[model samples]
Each structure stands twice: as structure tokens, then as C-alpha cells.
Target: MVVAEIAEALDVRTWQLQEAKDQLSEVIETAQVRGPQMITRHGRPRAVLLSAEEYLAMTSDRPDFKEWLLGGPKANLALPESAFKATGEAKVEK
Candidate 1:
């Protein structure tokens, strides 16, 4: 695999994900000490192997959708009462 080119740029270990599957334990150990380990398929980057601590550190404290919207700028506008008005039209015709 063309891992050398990618690894040098990112300063991390690179592995062809399929070829490296047999040595997954070694990959995990390396990621714990060396930050992220890049995984590639068909010589293209596909994923990263990260330690649990690192994963949690990166993902923790993420805001949910409701919290995200609530934290944004408040709108000054209000819904118009006319928006709720019903149309005085017939439901059906013969």
C-alpha cells in the first residue's frame, strides 16, 4: 500500500486497513501512544484508530440539537395571530 506518503505528511502510522486487520491489537497500542493511526483502503484514507481516552476527549461535551439552537442568537419576531385563522370554505362538493 502507498502508506508511506500519507504517514509522512500526517506524522503518524498508516496501514492498509484490510491488510492490518490481523494486527489490530498492535494498531490500538500504537494509537494510544502516538495519537491517531491512519487506516486506508485502496491507498485512500478511510478511518483513524484512536485511544478510548482520546476519542472521549474529542467527542465529549458535544451539544445536542436543542441545546445548539437554544445557544444561538434569539429571534425578536413573534408568530402572527392571523397565521392560525381557519378558512371558511366547504369541505366537499357533489
Candidate 2:
């Protein structure tokens, strides 16, 4: 088996997207101020700009948090022996 990947650009879809025209220095700053950017070519929607962190988190594989909490197994289980040692009656506070 063989695997190969060609360099392809990312496509962001939005109602409209204006071409990004700024120095690398300003890209981050602009996105921060604009609150997620929209990209358009000519007069149609194309893509959106996102902060690096946002993009990473969005694209990254997020664990099934709730599933993880219950992952190992499920069944009727009892508390540990130490817990049972407490006894049915509350200890009389002296």
C-alpha cells in the first residue's frame, strides 16, 4: 500500500470573504480585532479567518469527554470496603 498527499489550500466558506491583504505581522492582529474574519473573492463568499489557537482547537481531535468519564465499564458496583466500614448509623458526635 502507498499513501500520498498533494499540497492543497484550505477552503473556508462564509457569506463573503475579502482577500487578505496585509503583512504577516498584521494578520494575527487583524483577526483578533475583527473577531473571526470573512473571506470573499470578487463578490461571493469563500472562507473565514481564525486565530491560530481557535483553528487548532477546532480542527484537532477532541476526546469524547463525557464518554471518557464513563469509558472503562458500567455495572452495578458497590463502594469500597473502607466506605462500608463507616456503618449504617452515624457516629454519635461527642
Candidate 3:
């Protein structure tokens, strides 16, 4: 879901957060099982509580630019022998 939607779904207002300070265990538990928990301040979203596993999963290794380019679409084109000549337009086969 989108960030705003998720925030609305698991929103914790400023005062509510203060009240739940002693019971943060529940917050942490819910955040882990139900996705990110949003903390709002003055009606604006301030922060989020995400499980470590989820955080790590989001930040996991990914292919670098070179690898991505190499793995991209391949073009199997045919060129005439004189295509590389210095004087005229290259002849390319469709």
C-alpha cells in the first residue's frame, strides 16, 4: 500500500504515542506482524516503525548498473560489409 494509506491504517497520534509508551511492546509486535506503524505529530506523519526483517529485506543487495545493462534486452541486428565505411550512411538490415 502507499505510504499515506499505511500511515492512516496504523496511525499513532502524538498523545496516543505518549500514552502507549509503557506498552510499546504491543506497538512493536503489531508493527512486525502488520507492516509499518506510523507515528503522527500535530496531524502530520512523522516517523514509521518497521520490523528489522522488513527493513533488511527492503535494503537487500541488488544488481548494479553494469549488471542491469548487461542483462537488458539484446538486439540481433545485421549490418552490411561496407556499413563501417567512413564516407556514407551505414546499411542496416531490419
Candidate 4:
């Protein structure tokens, strides 16, 4: 979900969040203790607070992503030769 939706779920006014500044440690601790925080500035939410675990999951490698994408649609869609010229060969075919 977008950070705005998270703010709404947490019942926080978008403008009520604090400025991120250099308070990452404080923000993270506060967020962990109080759920995610919304960093705001000039009365607008700017960023989100995610736990280290959450962050790791977000940035973590998607082991099955390629497989998932390739397995999707399960149909062949032909493309021009020029497309492969820049995109490289498809390791798997439909």
C-alpha cells in the first residue's frame, strides 16, 4: 500500500507526521513501538517508517520473480527482432 494509505490505516493525519531530519533512529524506534510513522514537512507527509524486517523484505531478492513473470500469461507474444537486439535473449520460452 502507498504511505498515504498506511497513514490512514494508522489514523494519523498526513500533516501530523514529524520531519525525518536526522532522527532515523528515533523514528525507527518510535515506529517499531508505535507502528509505522509518517515523516512530514510543510504539513505534508513525505516518507514512511518501516521496520528493519519490513525494509529487508521490501529490498530482498525475489528468488521466484523471474519464474513468476515467465510463467504468467502462459502464451507466446511475438516481438520484432529489434526488441531482442536491446533486451537480450529470453532464457525461457513460452
lDDT of 1 by residue, 1-94 (tens): 4577768888988888876798998899999988899998898888988999999999999999999989999886854555445554444323
TM-score of 3: 0.49
Q: How much lDDT does candidate 2 score? A: 0.52
Candidate with more favorable, higher lDDT: 3 or 4 = 3
Indicate which candidate wins on TM-score: 1
1-94: candidate 2 lDDT, tens digit per residue: 1111110122222233223654444555666665455555665445566888788878788668887777767776755555545776444433
Best by lDDT: 1
Clashing pairs in 2: 12-47, 17-39, 17-40, 18-39, 18-40
lDDT of 4 by residue, 1-94 (tens): 7657867888653433444556666777776676656777665567677777777878877658788788678655777667776788764445
User: Lowest summed lDDT over 10 consecutive residues: which window, candidate 2?
Assistant: 1-10
- Clashing pairs for model 3 are none
Q: What does candidate 3's lDDT look like per residue over 1-94, in tens digits?
A: 6545655565632224564476688778877887776665555556777889999999789788899899999987866567667557665555
Better of 1 and 4 by lDDT: 1
Worst 10 residues of 3 by lDDT: 11-20
lDDT of each candidate versus the true structure: 0.83, 0.52, 0.67, 0.66
Task: Give me the displacement of residue 50 in model 3, in angstroms.
Answer: 0.4
TM-scores for candidates 1 onward, in order = 0.71, 0.37, 0.49, 0.49
- Residue 18: error of model 3 in Å? 1.8
Residue 78 lDDT in candidate 1: 58
List of clashing residue pairs for candidate 1: none
